[model samples]
Target: MKIYSFRKEEGKKITKYDSNFIMSRIIQSEKPVHVGCMHLEKNGVIGYHQAVVPQLLLIMNGEGLVRGERDEYIKVQSGDAVFWEKDEWHETKTDLGLTAIVIESEELNPDSFMALRIN
Candidate 1:
């Protein structure tokens, strides 16, 4: 069993992300799950990118705007959860600053499922 605290991890600037954006890794496992926390200062943005794997973003505090391939953006706030499928293009920006937990899995395989027999 393992426990991780976001406060313990030091934030690192992600070169690919816009200025004032930083991330701290929380957990990385061979089980396909990778977890991290991201902080975006006011007016910060995460440039458009595509998810190589499935991803889930959980809003921890503040508010932000998320945009997919579409031109429109969706406003999200604390307690909101967002999902992005593999290869889906997305981006995020915050005017009020935002903190969120990111969870992703690259090992998701639809072919590995086994049908269960039911009586």
Candidate 2:
């Protein structure tokens, strides 16, 4: 068993990100799942990118805009959750700043379980 506290963890500034952002890795294991928290300052942006694995972003505070491969963008606020499939291009930005928790995994194959269980 493991316990993690965002408040206790030190945030590392992501220098590679196109925009100003800080991230705190909460849980990283060989189990295939990774969890972290991202903080974006006002008017900050996380430039276009794609995840190698499936990802879930849960908005924790403030509001922001999310854009996918399409030209359209969606507004997201606290409590909102977003999912992105592997290699799906996406980006995020905010005028009022934002904080979110992110969960990602490469081993999210539901088909493997379905194959084992005859349903």
lDDT to native, each model: 0.67, 0.66
TM-score of each: 0.64, 0.64
Clashing pairs in 1: none
- Expressed as tens digits, the lDDT of each residue in 32-98 for candidate 2 is 6888999999999989998778776667899898877777787877755566679989888999999
For model 2, state the Cα shift of residue 61 in Å: 0.3
Candidate 2 to truth, TM: 0.64
lDDT, residue 82, model 2: 65
In angstroms, how far off is 115's CA in candidate 1? 25
Pick out the ten consecutive residues of candidate 2 with the lowest summed lDDT: 110-119
What are the candidates' C-alpha RMSDs? 13.3, 13.0
lDDT accuracy of residue 8 in candidate 2: 15
Stretches off by above 4 angstroms in model 2 are: 1-31, 108-119
Clash number for every model? 0, 0
